[model samples]
Target: MSNCKKISLSQILLLVLDIILILGVITTVIVYYNTFFKGSGNLNGLNKFIMFALLTVGITCIFFIILELRKIVLTLIKGNPFVWLNVKALKRISLECFIIASCYIVNFIVNFGENKYKFIYLDSKGIHTDTEPIIFILAGVFIAILANVFKTAIEYKEENDFTI
Candidate 1:
């Protein structure tokens, strides 16, 4: 095999992901502070508590997905992209995505049929029809499929290793 010491696209993506994760955390903090601590809102104590819980869950899932991607990137940089560890990481990332999506769905359910903004934006017209959670759900399924593909690749690699 050719020497794999050079930087690759995966490395660049990893750097970008790291930056995004850092920025996301900072933004989450700032938004939470401004929304709750600023004391200029109509949300009650229970609503604020539920929203915070959901946000925490969603952020935790995102953090885990980023961490798994970092592990996968490191393995790819080492020229061992077909390792079982990567398969596990992909599976974990998929699960985290699904969890984040579920959290959004629950948020929607909690805010359903309410005319006032509670847990989620509730306008006189209708509930907040945010499709972000649906997108994340689809992304999770796609990642799960990708994980299966990686698992197959790992099997092929192991078989090739055993061959002459």
Candidate 2:
């Protein structure tokens, strides 16, 4: 597994996604410190804790989404992606997206009346915007619909197989 070998497109994509996930974890820690400690002095203890908790939840949800995507990609590699397992994985991915969206919504609500621009953070490179809850919510809806579509495909496939 450690040796370099011929890899398919799916395998390469999966490897890239894994690398991104690893970097995301590391970046989250740095962002956590910068946002709470170096951002502003007006942030109270409760605000800090809420932000930390929400960040953790959002990250965990993202982690699970990647895991589910890996499963689906493995199925794709096997040339049988339209299976019950993929459907379940898609369902989980959809739920995780919803959870992430909810966490962002909570953060937005918590910082609604704050004086600072809580939604935007400035770093060395440039100003980075937080995740938009509506985007993820819409993604959740789209993934859920896809899961159902896969379910129907499986049903039709099974029926055809039985008929044959």
Candidate 3:
């Protein structure tokens, strides 16, 4: 317990951003389910099942992300080691990045086909095409890296504190 009472403004900003990201995730899930799955007469049974599965997974991920964010916030409040908090957060963020990137790749492949074969398959009847998964992927990756950096910084700080 070093007498370090100074809180970095950047950490405050990161906490705020994490809160916003959690809210955005929730909104995205709601919009996705409502727009894609509600009263859609186009999809057959199998397709409907697949869509529901995807939605369920997406919602579950959002819940996990929120949980990780909460853990990080708790760590900050308790003034615990950042590395411990970041390990959990970074793992979630990395998984989210991979999931979002894979989803985009799958969507692209399913819709357009491989090797320039112009096969235009609709994702669903009423689903909006405006949500680009690439953005999510990139954001997830960025946050993951940020978390790792925080972890590293804390490790360095601990080392310096011990050297004195």
Candidate 4:
């Protein structure tokens, strides 16, 4: 096998994605702090619910961002070509997608009707109850498939390397 370790286009893409993900996490944190911690009056019942949702989604995104950073670090340290096609990487991607979906669901719940306060604190609770579970289930399914794909890709690459 050739010993060349030239950086590939895909590595560049992954690096860029990782940077963007980190920046996104930072932005989310800033927003959360500004909204929740800075002298904002106590979020009332419905506002509290919405704040919790945002916090949950933000935390999830931060976790995924950290995972992506780990993957990037591992790829650089190991000097591997297909590092991003690994189980850990897939898990991170799945988690990121799930966080995004959850954010959309929360946004929908918070803005569902003409009266913004109608769904607060159990009033019209059904309005906020439909989509999150389904989205979470779908995210779980995607994560499983992503894991399998990663394993298969890694195995295929190994087989090809052996053949050559």
TM-score of each model, in listed order:
0.83, 0.80, 0.61, 0.51
Model 1: pairs clashing at backbone N, Cα or C within 3 Å: none
Please write out the lDDT profile of model 3 over residues 55-110, one tens digit for every residue: 56766676676667667766666667476666768778678766756665664555
lDDT of 2 by residue, 1-164 (tens): 57878789998878988898899889988987787777846667898788788988998888888888988988988889989999999999999989999987887788787743345788899987765787899999999999999999999999999999
Model 2, global lDDT: 0.86
Model 2 pairs whose backbones collide: none
lDDT of 4 by residue, 96-149 (tens): 767666676676667678344332344444434345546665975677696777
The backbone clash count of each candidate, in order, is 0, 0, 0, 0
The lowest-lDDT stretch of 10 consecutive residues in candidate 1 is 114-123
- Sum up the clashes in candidate 3: 0
The lDDT, on a scale of 0 to 1, for candidate 1 is 0.85
State the lDDT of candidate 1 residue by residue for 47-162, as single tens digits: 88888889889988988888899999999888788889998998998899899988888887778788432445766887865677878989999999999999999888889989
- Total backbone clashes of candidate 2, pairs 3 or more residues apart or in separate chains: 0
Score candidate 1 by TM-score against the native. 0.83
Candidate order, TM-score descending: 1, 2, 3, 4
